[model samples]
Target: MNRLFPVWRRCAAVWVTGGLAAVLSVHAYAQAPTQRPAQSATQSPTAWTTSWSTALQEIPRIAEPPPLYQAPAVAGRTVRQIIVPTLSGTTTQLRISNRYGTRPLTIAGVTVARSAAGAAIEPGSASVVTFGGKREVVLGPGMEMDSDAIPFKVTRGAPLTVSVDAGSDAVMQAWHRIAGRVSYVSSEGRHAGDIPAAAFNVRFTQYAWITRLAVSGEHKGGLVAIGDSITDGLRSTFGADRSWPSELSRRLAAAGATPMAILNTGISGNRLLSGSVCYGDSLESRFEHDAAELPGVHTVVVMIGINDINFSSMPARRGLDCDTPHKVVSADDLIAGYRRVIATAHRHGLHIVGGTITPAALPPAREAIRLKVNEWIRDGRAFDGVVDFDKALRDPAHPDRLKTSFDSGDHVHPSDAGYAAMALAAEGVVPGAKR
Candidate 1:
């Protein structure tokens, strides 16, 4: 597979020769704070500026809730900690989406607190999020909005809380990820907008509608992981930092990359194309908003299409539909859909890396479709690079279903260890890139 990195490395080395030649001749040793950082010829030499624009306008209409029958409930569930590592010299703005809500939702308020506990957060240690303007927001049904940017300084692996207060009728659609323990912020004490970290639990008794998070920084852009539950780490143990994307970020930080942010935009039961199962349109339909619309997204890694086959096969398996008698989703359709996703990302100047659908240890009928789809995804050059999750998780003997240990029992989503392996395999595809 002819790829992007090998060629990029060669091109980058050539500039070093030219840069050293200029550095030796310039002898202006001025000791001032106006010193500038070296910039590559291909890079722009402009001061960092804060600007806002609407990347995608979500459809604002009351719709139906997703398949709660098959999906698990989130009630009485608590995310111990959310690790939000940010670039220096910037504030983080959070984006909440309600694309699948059945009624208008109102977010009473939110809090960003510091974590006292390591990794996982304990109850009663979070606070509120506020700024100069209004703190509360009223989001209509099926609409997505951004919060008033919260100005705060953060370090790597900083445990934080983004607790939301939802309206009574809010049917909050949340993306499930295994966030570790974090501390919470407190309300304004003697001075407003200058609340220090405290151990008071900021409680909210409403629904949560947080879709995206924007960290404003004066460095490289961010990476958005767009796909289904696999990217969302559905079967991965709750409260464990095992999601591949989460592992990828930790690896990037260890590699000394500046401000590399990751936004996991995976929804359970989602597909690359529209489906009746996942409440919203296909990955192709939501690509613009989910992947490209973040404040700064430099790359996108996509792993989807499994649910398309599974759901498409469901009707035929039950002898309910006549269109797909064999209950098989053709590779040709999946390939075409991949091309559309790649082309769209390229249009936004994003480096798109395709992820192979992990081997599903399903019945023989479904396994055949999985193999065929994985074949096209692996060999297809439509993507800039391929993350071979199939190779990473498939059992050696079977070559279709994941190994028993890696399998999440349903044979669709991966276990925590399996997701970590996939993330480790995808490491180099987006190396040293910033957010």
Candidate 2:
């Protein structure tokens, strides 16, 4: 009876041990697939993305505006078919600004669509834009709002037309005056989602309220061109994106190199040291906002000071009162301003390339200062690199004047060919750009 009891106990212990091992193995097998999916969700490829932006600024109302600077205001009406160029991306957004408005700017509705023809949208491509998931947005004075991302695919260099209906409360609005492109305005109706070009009758050359278009994609960074009228595409064909910076963007894309977006922050009649109500803020004051703070921006190309030198000598030419202070600045003063720009850029970890002031028909006094400044830009080593714009656009026969072929007949600003040359000269120095 004792031997039988010992055998029974041994068999019972073996059976219990085997049963526990089998239970643990089944539990581990059940957990294996669940763990793998969680790991993969964390390692998703969609995590890598960037924002490419088009920077905008306020256009101060001028007292005696020229024919081209006459951009009308928006109130109780729909501004339809404002065409804008953007960098390539899978998703898109809109930035509306009221930075200089005295009252709250109320936007009733907005829409974006693929541009089909003049003031027309492609079929079934229009998307409603919202702010925080709401269609109506009210921006307080000196404020900017970004719309929620819409699932819209955009190709490089393709134009998108944005439509807006500014409610009756919107008054004293800001604008991009020298849009260099055509936009259509409707006579008091909410045609933001319409597809017909016939609904818009009043043709204009300005972008109102809309500040920037941001896109999501894979890109290294952005390149910003900060300058005066020359960089503003003054003489380039209307509605054609022939600005030097635009040309540079096309060149970069054609090379099939690493992706980089270009942002142009040029304002016509702008000066580097002085801020006039009509010419926007001075480069010294606006540097941080325009050049340094831009999203995905790492390289800045600067070309200014011609207006600083020219306007100082002839303030009356632009109908300015000669009594304006700080009109005349020496070469040293201009160089000092350049240094300040460099310091600000460096502090923000931006790689700045200085562009030599292009030649124009100037008085000897102004020309001498331009030469001195150019010499310092080339030899002083104050910038990360230098783009010799003077050498590129100046006539070898007469170094003080613009090449006759490149001149836009005003002895200032560049023709289409000249703008192309400027782009070529600077392409090699753009940060992360493949030369």
Q: Which candidate number maximizes lDDT?
A: 2
Give the runs in model 1 whose Cα sits over 4 Å from its true position: 1-90, 101-103, 117-132, 167-207, 277-279, 315-328, 363-365, 433-435
Q: After superposition, how far is residue 165 of candidate 1 from its true place, in Å?
A: 3.8
Q: List ranges where model 2 is wrong by over 4 Å.
A: 1-70, 81-86, 315-326
Each model's lDDT comes to 0.53, 0.70
RMSD of 1: 11.2
Give per-residue CA lDDT, model 1, range 205-243, as digits (tens).
211344444454465656678887788777677556567
Report the error of model 1 at residue 368, Å.
Answer: 3.5
Cα lDDT of model 2 by residue, 348-373, tens digit: 66667788999897878888999999
